[model samples]
Target: MSELRRFLEQLTAAPSAEALWDLHCSKMAEYGFDRIIYGFSHYMSETSMGDPEDFILLTNHDPSYMELFIGNGLYRDAPMVRWALHNVGACSWRFLWDEMARGALTEREKQIIAINQRHNVTAGYSISFKAITSRSKGAIALTAREGMTQAEADEIWAEHGSDIVLMNNVAHLKIVTLPHQSTGRSLTKRQREALEWVGDGKTTQDIAMLMGLTSATVEKHLRLARESLSVETTAQAVLKAAFQNQMFIVDGIQG
Candidate 1:
């Protein structure tokens, strides 16, 4: 009966990522963070962020700012992002300033700091969720509204850091359940179930038994899944489906 539980119920009911993100932005705004960028990569490794198209990046910053930050590769040099990549949990931006004070930041990181300052994104914290796998990373950058000082933002975090972290964590957990739709990529009900079973390490015979179908029908579904996902093999199809957050979706039941 708590307000937080009701909000979470609404969040989990949001049928689309866009709808959920709007709710998130509003909630964070109530807590002094007026801007946020949340990005998730399910297929990243040390070598690459994987395909640019597979990333689930949601933000409420000005279009021009995002255009420059992502289009110009400024995120590569963002100190908060770097910190999140290496560590988990929330931390205030004071650490970035501390790094700057100690003369440890690279020129690129300093430039990003200046950009953030100019754009009224001068104070906030970054919370990086624990990596569920070596190949996945998800994090959020929350920027305090204009006029809030670093000290004030730090004070807010000191008082409410655990609450903020819990909310963002719930947001991420709800996000992976919503379907991701993209150009020329979608899976049928059967295709999704087949891929889910494969990702669960089931063979064609196992999937057929579970789905009450012949092995040949399961193989057909797997082949179609591979074609729909633009992958070459069943394994690749399963990985691609998971990366796109398409497998194990609720109500994936076939008609």
Candidate 2:
């Protein structure tokens, strides 16, 4: 297997969230991207589903370029941020620029692009993923030197899809490691099943019918979910469960 494949296999075998994050960072450095950043919202707190705040921000750029990025808050108006908000999958810099050209861009955005070009950061690729916690999301971006071609971008995406997914998963794990309740009452099998259904956007009535329970019974289970997660509403319960890695939605599981 290729190194990327081996790394992914290792990630699959990782026994803890910390181990997974370390593996992801090491493998990402091996992929030769100039920079990578993963961010999550405030949802992941205590469960076993994934971490929302845990992120890995890596860069191989010169110290000066890094300094410039932070000094100007370029990340605030970055094209990658736009791409992550609008696109849910993988894409490249050329395509990103092409899309930007077709959209209305502020002078600040244009200036950021100009700065990137001046620094020879002419090409980039990103694979964005939806955050299971909160309403926030994130992506992993890889940038290349000037004159890089679309073929190279595609090659990187094809070669590194699994690594990108693994990185995101580990990031989720880290978000759940915040100092708080480390151990709580374990979720019952039925609670776990119901939580997964809720995460998939199922209505209580629908879940009741699917599980062959009364709608009131469904509500009772959801009430338990809310109390167990210490959240006020079902939505908060679902989001909290997701962020804390307490519940894994069947549909959201990636290979």
Candidate 3:
């Protein structure tokens, strides 16, 4: 077996969230990628559930891209952001060029892509995951400079897909280990219903009609779901709820 495969097997056997994060970082290093960032938007704040924002950020990029990413709000317009919004499982940096060619690029997004190109960041891949309870919707991004081939990308994806899933699962396990005072309360029935609907790919209007409630009421429930889960968006809320088994799976369609 490859070293990365062995690491993943060990991670699967591990009993702790920290151990999983450690294994993930080690595997990313083995892949020859210059940077790996795993971010959970829902768990960015409110650590009642054991700090879900705890991340493993590995990078050899010049500090300049880091500065621009944070200082200039490039993250808001990043192609990764768009991918997350659309719930894409995996994507390449080349998609950014395709988006630009299609005239779908915003000025800020174009600028960030340009900066990355100038910095020799030839390509990257991002994988998003459903959030665990007390956590946020999450994504793991691996970036590399020139010479990263499609075969290499496919190898990383096949090798590390389970690791990404386990990362969020272990994070939730950590929350379950926390004291009652540290962990937040469970979801309400209405919140659960809304989450199930969202996980089924039902829009707010669709859910409202199904439940005999106004769309605004459905929106309110979703908003509460997001706040209670410490997630910033509805999609994150659905992801987290599904991870916790508080929401049911229907049609195999995730929110």
Model 3, residue pairs in steric clash: 42-231
Please give the lDDT score at residue 187 for candidate 2. 55
The prediction achieving the highest TM-score against the true structure is 1
Q: Go through the candidates in order and give each one's C-alpha lDDT.
A: 0.85, 0.62, 0.61
Each prediction's TM-score against the native? 0.80, 0.51, 0.50
Candidate 3 lDDT, 1-255, residue by residue in tens: 965456556755655434555665565655655576655443443423124232223334467876676446566568776686557366665677688899998887788778777766656677665544334555667776367764676577577656545553443344333212113455677887988888888988999999899999999988888877778988887766654445643322221
Model 3 earns a TM-score of 0.50
Give a tens-digit lDDT track for model 1, residues 40-93.
Answer: 888777877666556778899999999888777788778998898899998899
Task: Specify the highest-lDDT model's number.
Answer: 1
> Considering TM-score, which of the candidate structures 2 and 3 is the better prediction for this target?
2
Model 1: how far is 223 from its true place, Å? 8.1
Q: Per-residue lDDT of 6-78 in model 2, one digit per residue for the tens?
A: 6557766665544565666566655555455445445233332133223233345577876676544686677
